[model samples]
Target: MSTRRAFAAACLAACLAACLPWYSVSAQDVRANGQKQPPVSSRGRLPVTGCAGQPISDIIVITQPPFTERLPTRLEWVRRTVRKTHANTRDEVVRRFLLMKIGEACNQIQRAESERILRAQPFLVDARIRVFDDEAGGVRLEVETRDDFSMIFEPTVQSKSPLVRGMRFGDSNLGGSATLAAINWRDGRAYNDVLGVELENYAFGRGRNEFRLSAQRHRFGQDMRLEFVRPYYTDLQRYAWIGSLGGTREPIEFRRGDLPRNALTVRREFANVGAVTRVGPVGRLRLVGASLTREVQRTDEQSLLLTREGVIADTTDVAVPTFRPQRVVRVNALLGVRAIRFVQVQGFDALTGAQDVRVGMQLGLVAGRSILVRQARDRDHFVAANLYGAYGGTRSFVGLQAVTEGRYDRDAKAWDNFVTSGRLAWYFRPAVRQTTVVESEWSAGRDMRVPFQLSLADREGGVMGHRNSRQAGARRLVFRAEQRLVVPTRLNIADVGFAGFAEAGRLWAEQSVPYSISTPWRGAVGVSVLAAVPPRSRRLWRVDFALPVSADPQRRFEVRFSSIDRSRVFWNEPRDVQAGRERTAPSSLFTWP
Candidate 1:
């Protein structure tokens, strides 16, 4: 068949399929007239898992609705025309983003992966893939897409906290590709105003590379960054690299008032280079190196303590570190093995693990040295290591990660300044659409990494509470359990439906800090409404509510009505196939964003 004729036939078939109930094609069977049906792999193929390839003889692009500004139709149309004219996300970019080509087999794994990746773009709101029967006995891959409003003008005055104010004006989808550019400014009564601007391109080099530039001005100081990444840069199709240079100048606030105003100012600069590659079939390796420099600037002010007179008083007890400049080198390593099973999905986003092996494991090592750069005590060689393991199935998922760091001093002749962190989690679905998850986490050390700290405060991260106080522990442990009820509904709203949850956690250190911990575990209970998100969203929506389990002297109740799910994968199998997936690439920052 001719190319155009083949596409025309595919279009006709797509029209038919679109009109049919989605469930109608869930399974394939032989026709009574001895016609063979496409073979259906009994294995489950979740969108998150991967895609299967069917030979493609044709390709189709289906553009869906656009998020036009609410301006008059004429104005919006003109705006859209201008935007589209300069769009880097043209049909060419979309084709470049696909793992499957016109002459190649239609890979469902890459199909879903591409859809998921595109959805993450700031400019795209929806991306869906469908395969149709072609006239040449080949498959036709159809990609349906919708673009988000590229430009946004946001002005805000937030009083939810202490009468804070802020505004952001930017175009998230600059030049039509997954590029972002915007300006943000905000301030409060203390002149705590912040101004920042950023430009990012996720589709540089046809989506295999990225470039970013950012600058921020804070009330106390400023920050800036320049980054570039070549996501896949190897003939083995198993390696990638990233380079970044950034710096920050900021103030650190201490608990005591005697430190005076801006008594200490910290400036830090760093440059990083990292690479990751698949070792064997199931194992992968990563190496990262960085050079860092730090300097401190201090000023003295009236000590807020007076004997009796109304004059500025002075009580001398607090001592500040001698201002110093330091430089160091940092290195990190990660290795992991992973395996997953795909079960046949019978319904929309339905997952059921038929007895199958699904597991993941990872190990990491970090090293720091300043001997080459500066002869400083703090820069002595230090090493950190971490391990993680997990198992997941349709109804259950469990995982744990542990880390430890220390430095061996020649004079001490032993490893000292040890720090540790660990986390464990288990989830089970007892019935259709119902899941119960239990999790525990802890951190402590003479010197701990940023993530090791126990976070019981509502602002610590995702876990919920009523207040906003961040506390740390030398060795702290927290326990959490929650139940999610998946209502039998589909679409963007209330997909899994709802959840009722209870959480309890505590933070304690080798040395106690006031208001940092309590003898009893702090517990809270709340409920939420979940949306049926594309596999990308993990089918979650707004948190709805997170309340304190009891009353406390500190009204530190923290509450958030919205939640956006960004998954992080510790150990991922490099093989992208449930069927024909592009080799899975580990994210540079978090997992899928």
Candidate 2:
């Protein structure tokens, strides 16, 4: 079949499945068909359990009237007519009747649910109801308060502890100049100086409400230098308020503060504040809120226009680009129904063109398995799906993942194209209680792509910014594979584990691109030994040896890896260099086991 036709079929299937009733156990009831049951009294009650305080006899009555007098009495007759019938058709008759009865009962119960709820709450002394002149079926209740109303708006008690820690190590140049140096707290040692100092508190008021206020400051270097970075001193203050009205299902939060990632000097000056409220029935409420913020960005001085040869030329001149504070309203919803005892949902909205929104959902199935769906809509829309499942025990697992996204071009009136990618990891015992693992990833897009890890220059010169080469003319494909191993305990005196991995793959720049030279292929091999350490600390050290067999556009083959963290070394041409000039890269010490 054609690609278009295949895609259409998949979309149809997803829509149909989503529209079906998610959870209705009555349809699946089979006991009524195979066995007899005791009758209930006219007053409506169930067999009691535990004690009298449980009010077991006062079970919520859910009986309803029959829709049709001629409806069949047999279990089979009921199954076929109910809106949601049991998957097993053996008790088709009874399942159908029970479902219809449930629908009618829900309507009657919903009508008087509020009154029933008020009587159920033992703390309520009295309540007042008010209705708006323009609205119907919308009743507002004011729980009479005896204390001050300001106390009711206070914040709730919450976990507000902030942790900060850092470490430093250095080996001085020996042989020629070895002299005692003063402890300046610059070459590491001051664990607290490199990280930061943070204090937070969430105090509650007499009305049983709470709010949080926090502040933090950090110094990057011992000298507290302000070069390169705009702010020499960083200060941030945050505030969040939460209160629960007696009639509401959950606490309503009034947050006048910054998001975790929005910590910046400009944000503190402008200040962003918002409130969120739930909009669903009891036990289920969607969050609706808004925030106002000012965004600031620094531009390189080289990018600025300069006079050269009496003509304007691009020059780098740092300038802070500040935008007026803008208000962005956001709203989202979530729903939960116990079927597999898991829930999945999504929501997104940006009140105006100046803002954007994104959403994601996930479903966890029985066992260690899960499915995820995510989408982001801003300047463009992108969607992806992934699945994760674990099968092996400690130190081993078989993982499979896949994702695809499309970038839409408004001016072109069409999506640039869709890119699909997938990866698989399989582990096996290669030695006594030891293991060797193999993994591979593949991606295909519009003639310009490579595996994520192989994008050596992604930080500054990623594939997306490549200079024009011939159009290559069709979709491209990139593939990569790696195998790693762990040695047995007998290999080392201390029983330390050994691991090694090698990877190789090809990049197809175009449908016609040759699998050989035209498509750059590379391979790498590395080995490391892990030492055992204390249970609560990751201070365990590792020594690694890696050789890069692939040559970059610079025509250099390198062989270098680091200890502790793989950031201070690089392989370049004929030299294995130590990159101590600056932070060359983030520590690659955290990887999945």
Winning candidate number (lDDT): 1
For residues 431-538, write the lDDT of model 2, one tens digit per residue. Answer: 343555565655444311111111322211112212111122122233333333323442211224455656554444443211212346545556665542211011
lDDT tens per residue, model 1, 1-593:
34334334433432342233211111123345976454343223222222345567655654432432343554456546644533334454555566676778666556655665555454554566777665465666666665544555666655676443777776655545556677778873453468777677777777556787777777656777667776542212355567776656654332222233212345565666666555554224343333232222222332333212322433545543332243445444434333322222111122211121225555555454444434333435556565666666656677776656665554446554465556677767777767776777665544311112233442432246634433433345666677766566323212456777777766555532212333345667778766533322232345557677644333244545543322323223111010011001123521212
lDDT of all predictions: 0.48, 0.24
Off by over 4 Å in 2: 1-384, 389-396, 403-412, 416-422, 430-432, 442-454, 457-495, 506-519, 535-541, 551-593
lDDT of 1 at 512: 28
Residue 556 deviation, candidate 2, in Å?
5.9
